[model samples]
Every structure is written in C-alpha cells, then in structure tokens.
Target: MPLLPPWFHVRLTFGDGAVVDARAVVSEGRITIGDLSAGPPAPPDGHTAPADFAGPARHRARPSWPRGREGRRLVAEAYRAAQSEGRDPVLAVMRETGRSRRRSLRLVAAARDAGLLPPRHNRH
Candidate 1:
C-alpha cells in the first residue's frame, strides 16, 4: 500500500499562552479534519479549568442581585418558572442577572402574593 500527500498538521498558539493542535487531510476532492485540542493538552485522566473557573462563575462583572424594581422583575420571572414546574428554579437573577438568594426569595414571595402564582387550596 502507498500513502498520499495533501495531509497537514499545524500548531497554533495565542498570546494568552493558549495553544491548539490541528490535523487536516484533503484527498480526492474530499477533506477530513482531526480533533482540535485547545490550551495545554488535557491530562490522560480528564480535563480541568483553573481553580477560579472550576464551577459556576460568580464574577464581579455581574453583581449577584440587581437593585430595586429591576430586581423585583428578575425574581418574579424566576418565581414563575418555579411555580410552573411545581418547584423553585434558579432564575436568571440567581444564575445570570445576579441576585442574592435572600433577595430573590423575598421578591419571589412578593410576586407570589401579588398573584404571580395561582391561589393555593388547602387539601385534607
């Protein structure tokens, strides 16, 4: 058997100390690409992010809770989602828009009392 040309491998690096390895092949008018790995190659066991980015981000760019009226609206939406599924949900406020759990909880209660959720009926 004989091997052909048109295959290439290249390494790319970024100023931030990141790197990616690329492999490509073009044969008979068809092209194929291999896996691209970014940054330092992952360990055999698994891949991991820096400690500060290990899990859900709690970054300064976004505050945990919005202020005043906007915060109210954010929590209301979360509360609505929570009620629909018959349980509390992590709203954009909690996970993205950024609202404190305590604040979100209070706002949720307010929205509920304000008629976001249907009235409860006691059952025996």
Candidate 2:
C-alpha cells in the first residue's frame, strides 16, 4: 500500500543534536498525530554525542572538568597538589577549574568515589 501524504509536517532539531519529525494526518476533517518517542532521538550522523553535554540546548554549558575517569584523576591530582602546597583543597580546585566551592566539593567527592583519593575521615 502506498503511504499517503500527511496533512501537516514539521521537523524539530534539539540542541543536543536530536532530530524529530512530526506529521499530522487529517481524515474526515479530524486530525490525527502519531506518538512521540519515549526518549530523545539519536544524532543523525550515527556518531555518539558528547557525554558531557547536559541541560537544554539554549541553556547548555560545558563542564569545567574533563569527562569520565580522566576528570576524576585530574580532580584527585588537584587535591594532592593543594595538600602538598599547604593551600586549601577546595580553594585550589576552585582556582584550577574556576568552579564554585559547592561544585568543587562535588568533584572532590566524585574523585574519591573513583578511588583516586583516600576516603574522607570525617562524615558530614
């Protein structure tokens, strides 16, 4: 059977490189639309999108640290450097990554979770 043209067609491209095609059909003067995908569509080029990309396209911002294990390693190294230099670790991380104190703390926690840093003695 031949496919009939939709009454309306629209294409949407998201900031994270997701593309979606929407089509509406009009039958007996009633409009019908198809169900959308449960999740965002993959990039059109078949290449994997950057894992670091977060949030919506319009408000997208790059992360301060590198992605994955390398980022954790870097954070652990920064903490070690700060301790060696007798400077505050959080402040040192802030200087190195230009991230806020809270964000630096989170990064430090991630580094510790990655086994790059020794366990924290005090629980908060």
User: Each prediction's Cα lDDT score?
Assistant: 0.63, 0.78
Query: Model 2 RMSD to the real structure?
Result: 12.8
**Candidate 1 lDDT over residue span 79-101, tens digit each:** 56765787756454366455578
Instruction: Write one digit per residue (lDDT tens) for candidate 2, span 11-101.
Output: 7787765667767778777878764433355766887756755555774354556878987788889899999999999888877777889
Stretches > 4 Å off in candidate 1: 1-6, 40-63, 66-70, 73-106, 112-124
The RMSD (Cα, Å) of candidate 1 is 9.4
Point out the worst 10-residue segment of candidate 1 by lDDT.
40-49
Task: Report how far residue 64 has shifted in candidate 1, in Å.
Answer: 2.3
- Model 2: pairs clashing at backbone N, Cα or C within 3 Å: none
